[model samples]
Target: MINQSELENSKEVGIITDISDKELHLALGLSDPTCNNEISQQDQNESTHDTSNSTAPSEPQLFFQAVGLVRGQYLPSTEKLGSGILLLDDGVIAPTNLLASAVYTVKKHPNLLESPQVWIVYPRVQVKNPPFLNFAIRGARLPLEGEDAEVINQSVDDFSIRGIVTYTNRKAGNFVIKVYRNFMPWKEQEGTKYKPHIFTITGVLPSEGLPCGQFWDLKVKRVADQLVLEDATFITQVFEPKKPKKGRSKRQGQKRKAKRNQSNPQ
Candidate 1:
């Protein structure tokens, strides 16, 4: 047998004894082994918090963008009652029901040969009963049975029909007037082109388009034996709220990934 000191030296040299975790904890005066678990739990909670507060992507908005004169026209069933045809800017005649409203600004006033004429046609709207065209003009206050003969010519020839209220018979489809100047008031803002005769006729639909079979017969309401202008419609092509776009953005994709990772922690 070896000597005691030799045995002790041999054990110390041959096998290095390390302190156990239990011994280390006891030395450090720690009773709870769950501290590490608590730290891990805190880290997880922080990750979840970051993910919860993250913002997703936003959607785009909808608005109306106007398309030009190629989209204009008179309403349906109002033909054969005019001295001259109301042609488009391209010299093409506007079809019936081209517009969803009756309000037209006279860009080019009519000559004696090419009179300003249109047929009053109404648009179809959603209602229990069909709607009627109630015709009336404004600002005209036509001379009171020969108050002054010159008053008629001046009123008719003026480049501005703003607030001029006149009347037409609701008996026929031919609504006629004559403009003598090619007034483009819209151009007035760009430069002094020509003074425009803007006619603000009422009884037009505020929006566009009409469904099938939604029109009523003409309603005759005369303002001092003058024909009323009603139910005429003009349509325009505009970009409104269309379908939403198809893909997600980079940040949005990252947000989705974060959510997935949160749901299933590694």
Candidate 2:
């Protein structure tokens, strides 16, 4: 299961963009086509049984055939990320076996003109894992001058970046590229552009040395005009909840090895 503890530990935040009520209904298992028929049958059968056999409605139970969707910007709080108002089929505490975060599943529409949508947000506990991380660069200019094409945040795993980027004068193949743990590098990857003061980095967790609860600083050599310079600082943190690891079976491992061999083509 997705680890909520780590998410809670990390001091990161996000805002809810959009929400889809229809998708949420499906997620909550409230949109069953046979729901009405099943309820009718159950009621009829209960009527035939002894009146005493019927479950007493001592406590009132609320039933919702439909739920409303509210979309807005949920600003970040000290403890957790922001969230949208969504009425779920049932009131369920997140961090249960089923849910990875407070919000069930988020559909991202990055470039959409409309406000992004988020399904639900509980009043008490904010989501530990947000859909993405907001990364902003400070005190830096675009298109790093000289041999320093860009400062790439290399990640060995999907959750957080943990790798090395060296500045060398080899004269060939010295360009640094940014990439996620298991994802391919962006085709148009370039150095940090100063246009957008804030940027987003999507990852699940931090590197081994980095603390889970706090942000860590990375001091890199600032480059300008083909000259080595003093240390430039960059910060990194886990944006969202890291996906749970899946154990690989023997057959799957064998298949991976075979695929690797085919690609190498000895």
lDDT of each: 0.26, 0.25
Name the 10 consecutive residues with the lowest summed lDDT in model 2.
59-68
Q: Write down the TM-score for model 2.
A: 0.15
For candidate 2, give the lDDT of residue 65.
12
The predictions' CA RMSDs to the true structure, in order, are 36.9, 23.4
In candidate 1 the C-alpha lDDT for residue 41 amounts to: 57
State every prediction's TM-score relative to the real structure: 0.15, 0.15
Number of clashing residue pairs in every model? 39, 9
lDDT of 2 by residue, 1-266 (tens): 22233323323321221213232223223332212323355665765574442222211121111111222322223453322222212322122111243222222322221332222221111224642221211111213355342231221011222211211112121211122111111232344322101112222222343222122222222111011212222333222223233456688899999999999996
- The deviation in Å at residue 132 for candidate 2 is 23
- List runs of model 2 lying over 4 Å from the truth: 1-209, 212-214, 222-244, 247-266
**Can you list the residue pairs that collide in candidate 2?**
17-116, 17-117, 18-116, 18-117, 18-118, 19-117, 19-118, 159-204, 159-205
lDDT of 1 by residue, 105-143 (tens): 222322211432322222111223212212222111224
